[model samples]
Structure formats: C-alpha cells, structure tokens
Target: MKSLNHRTKVVILTAVMFVLLVAVYACGILISEEAVTGSFLNAKRPPCLEHPFGTDALGRDLFLRTLKGLSVSITVGLVASLISAVIAVLVGIAAANGSKWVDALINWIIDLVMSVPHTILIILISFALGRGLKGLLMGIAATHWCSLARLIRGEVLQLRSQQYVAVSRKLGKSSGWILTNHLLPHLVPQFFVGLILMFPHAILHEASISFLGFGLPPEQPAIGIILSESMRYLSTGMWWIAVLPGLTLVLIVLLIDKFGDHLRMILDPYSAQE
Candidate 1:
C-alpha cells in the first residue's frame, strides 16, 4: 500500500474514534438496570473472568455501571454543550451587530461570567436550581458560552469590516438580509468546531458537580456518583470500583478531546492544506 499521508491517517483515526465513542454510548443505552443490579452474594468480588471490573459493595457489576454512568454523562454533556453553543452564537452575533451600548453590556456580562471560576459558578448555579439533572444542565450551559461568544464576536466584527459586507451595506441590503446571506454561512464551521470542543468540558463539569453532590442525584448512575461511592470502599481493599471507572472516564474524555482536535484540523482550511 502507498504510505498514508498525514491527513489520511488523521481521517482514519478520527473515524475509528468516532465509531468507538458511539459504540460506548449505544452500549450504555442498550444496557438496562439488570446489567448493574446488585447481587449480595457477589458483593465486593475482585476482578475476575466472570466480572471483568469486579463487583461493588452492593454487588453491582462495575463495568455495566460505568457504561451506564458514562452514557448519562455523555447525554448531559451533549445537551448542555448544544445549548451553550447556541447561546454563544446568539450572544456573539448580538454583540457584534447591536448598538455600542448593547455590545458593551454583553461584553460586560461575558467578562463577569469569565471572572468566576467555572467550578464555583457551576456549583452555585446548580445549587440554586435545586441540584438535579435540570440544574446541572442549566449550570453548564449558562457558564460555557463566554469564551466561544467572544471568539464569534471577533469573527463577526472582522467579517463586518470586509469589503463585500460594506458593499452590501452600500447596496441597501438590510442588516438581517446581509447577516443571513453572508455572516451566518461563514460561522457554520466555527460553531460546529466550538460545539465539539465544548463537549469534554461539559462532561467533566457535570461529573465534578455531581461528585460534589450538586448535580445528579445519588440514585442516578453517573460517573461522579460511582466515584464518590467508591471512596468509602477504597480503604477496604476494593480498588477496581473506583480505579476502573475513573480511568474509563478519563480515557473517554481524552478520546473526545482528541477527536475534537482532529475535527478542527479537518475543518480548518489552513490546517487541511498542511
């Protein structure tokens, strides 16, 4: 075979990663409570052939629990990130196209949001919203838009200054018409790349908040909950419960982050030529 080029290699790798991630999510969805249901007789069993990840204190299969938890995390992340990305695009466009006062106000809000640490802000928001899935989603979606909004605002401003845009303005095109015909199309790439990049961050935040007891409820099979529960059993020589699942979470995050990078490279015209 002719040697694979860099772009080809990246494409293949990205495809594999995408498929694997989807498979994990699908498996998590396909698996029901029965896969994780407890059997006291098997409680606290160490890793073995029959139970690859062993059983937790309640004898729930750690593997299945981890998958279910991961699925929950991914779902939460996907929804929150999509919301955040939409908020970002809207805020960015508004700031760029609106009056100076409106722009200043939006910028101030962005700065204010960015001023606070994400974890702290998420915790406060999640707590105020009653600390469940809804709250967690709101918290994450509300917090993650600042940076992307700023980027989009800059891009829009630059595009607005271009000769074609000025010509459109001189030709009596309505602002809305110009925006729809010109600006929005250019923003598609940025929007998608930003959305993909935000996924892992959203996932991590969901897990962290849940671990702190302010996101998902304890009964929900979330990775954070699994890890938090494992804390109590770690001292009793049960390591698989936490270690395996924690590692799996990290691996998934890393894979997602890598996939985002690959996607960015593919989508970026400059990068694609290299």
Candidate 2:
C-alpha cells in the first residue's frame, strides 16, 4: 500500500466506499414491511438499545423506516440520473455535430431550462404530471441535464478538431461511425463522472419535492415524507424523528459526492499522473 501511487490509493478507497454504499442500498431494499410495522405499545419511544433510532408516533421503528425511505430515495435518484445522462449525451452530441443554427437552438433551450429555479420547476412539472413517482422522475430527469449536456457538447466540438478525427473523416468514415468509434469512447469518463455527480442532486431534489408534497404519495416510505410528517412531532420534543434520518441522507449524499470526486481524479489523465 505504501508503494501505491496516489491514483491507485484513490481507486482502492473509492472501491471501498462503493461497496459500502451498495450495502446500504441493499439493506434498505431487503428490509421487510414487518420490520417497520407499528404498534401502540412501542409508540414514541426515545432512542434505545432495542430500537436504535427509536419509535415514531405510530410505533414504527425509525431505524428500519429510515432505511426503507433511503432505499426509495436511492432508487429514484438512480433512475432519474440515468435518464438525465442519456438525454445529456444525445443532446450534447446533436448540438456539437449539427449545423450552427442547430447548436444555437439547443444552447437556448439549455439556458431556458437552467434559468428556472429547480425546486419550483420540479414542483410545477410534478403537479402537471399528476404528482406521483412518474411525475417526480420526469421532473428530476428533465431539469438535471443542462450542465452535463453543455459539457458533452463542448467536449465533442474539441474532439472534432483533433487530427485523428480529421484523419478518420478523410478516410471516408460516416459521422455515426466516427461518433461510435472515437467520440463516444473518449466521452466514457465524462459520462460516468457526470452521472455519479448528478446522483446527489437527483436524490436531494426528489426529497425536496416530496417534502413539499409534490413528489411522492403519502403512503410511500420516502425520506421526504418521513421528514414532512416529523414536523408536527418536533414541537413535542421528538427531535430524533427527523434529525437521525435527515443526517443519514446527508451522510449518504456526502459519501457519494466524495466517491465521485475521487473517481474523477483517478479517471482524469493529468490528475492521475500526480
């Protein structure tokens, strides 16, 4: 380990974090409904050895419930980020490869989307789409692609000016062939890093919209819904109800962000050399 390069060490660390994150998500998914079922006898208990996160007003174990909520949030984030990344890649390629007029039009659309406040826009979109899982997914996916699309577009333009690309064009390679053989391969790093970074934003937005009552339904076990319901109990000194779960969400986001940053460092040629 002492002989390892900085990039190698980062890769090892990132792998460990990735495993840890996967475990958390898996744990949440594996938890059963029975684990979080409520009973009046156990209601409103403060944190204890038996129930680490304590019980809520309905007597459900906050720990299990929180895990379940986190699982839901992670699922939403994964799906939304994937869709956004696809959109970003396609739009980016189009803007970079198409006519000047086409590029201008795409840029204008990106700017228009970015100009809106994300939370407000998500809320409006969610409401319009009927305010459930589908609505939230669409809203988050739609709003999160602008910056990444711009990055891909710029990268494609730069790649187009490269000697190898010009040589490929001279060899009579079709545009689609060049895109698949050259452009897309070079874009793998940017695509993955962008996707990872988008996750935190997606998760946060999902929580935010849900908390505002415009994302998921009340019946679903979501962090946003958990936080929203905890409001009334906070006045009664049930601080643990919201605090622990919220902290968990923050910690997960920070972990994911750290993983993305380290992975980016390892993948970047210049940074890896250092």
**Lowest summed lDDT window (length 10), candidate 1:** 1-10
Q: For residue 29, give model 2's deviation from the true position in Å.
A: 0.5
The TM-scores, one per candidate, come to 0.97, 0.98
User: Who wins the lDDT comparison?
Assistant: 2
Off by over 4 Å in 2: none
Per-residue C-alpha lDDT of model 2 across residues 45-156, encoded as one tens digit per residue: 9999999999899999999999999999999999999999999999999999999999999999999999999999999999999999999999999999999999999999
Q: After TM-score superposition, what is the CA distance of residue 115 in candidate 1 from its true location, in Å? A: 1.2
Residues 29-83 of candidate 1 have per-residue lDDT tens digits of 9998887899999999998989898999999999988999999999999999999
Clash pairs for candidate 1: none
* TM-score winner: 2
Q: What residue pairs are clashing in model 2?
A: none
